[model samples]
Target: MTRLTAALVILGLVILVTWALWQRSTAAEARADLAEQRLAESQQREAQHQMIIDSLWDNARRQANQRRALAKQQAALTRIASNRLATIEELQRENQALRAWAGTRLPDAVIRLRKRPAVTGAGAYHQSVRDPQPLQPARE
Candidate 1:
């Protein structure tokens, strides 16, 4: 009877140890799975962050290029405007010189004749037939 009881007790102890080992193994596996899930989530978040940064960099680069192009266009326009201003100043000087030369060369009588108002229609036709009167010099 004692031997039988001892054998039963030993068997029960063995079963309990096996059950404890199985529980421990299952708990360890659960912890490992949780860690793996957390790692995957962290990796995904990093990828998203990296993508956002890349997009921002690209936008900044494009804007900088546009600004550079705009500055270049403005510089070109300024250069053209300066060149046109120089040409206009030269033309004005030339016009003044020509006016001075023409004033000296043309006779006063001829200038007066050029300044006279034109008579139109019947009046103009009659004036052309009559002896023309000498035009009076204009007062400044």
Candidate 2:
């Protein structure tokens, strides 16, 4: 009876030890899986943050380029306007000189033009000047 009781106790201890080892291995596996998951999640967040930073830089670069283009366009327009104004002033001066010459050359004609308000209606002067004799070139 004593030997049988000793054998039964040994068998029970063996079963208990096997069960504890199995439980320990399962817990360790669960901890390793949890750690790996956390690491994966951290790497993904880092990649996402990097992408966001890159996009911001790209946006800023594009805006700067657009601003530069706009500034260049504004400078070109300013130059063109200045040139046009200068040309218009030159033409006005030339027109004044021509008017003075005409007054000296044909005083009577100028007086007649001044007395008569110009025919402003469309085609009013189209057929008005009809001298039967064509003008001859002057002999100097």
Top candidate on lDDT is 1
Expressed as tens digits, the lDDT of each residue in 9-101 for candidate 1 is: 999999999999999999999999999999999999999999999999999999999999999999999999999988877776889875566
Question: After TM-score superposition, what is the CA distance of residue 25 in candidate 1 from its true location, in Å?
Answer: 1.2
**How much is 137 displaced in model 2, in angstroms?**
47
Residues 19-136, model 2: lDDT tens digits: 9999999999999999999999999999999999999999999999999999999999999999998887777678987556645755554555565546676565553344243334
Off by over 4 Å in 2: 1-4, 97-140
For each candidate in the order shown, give its overall lDDT on alpha carbons: 0.86, 0.81
Clashing pairs in 2: none
Q: For each candidate, C-alpha RMSD in Å?
A: 19.3, 15.3
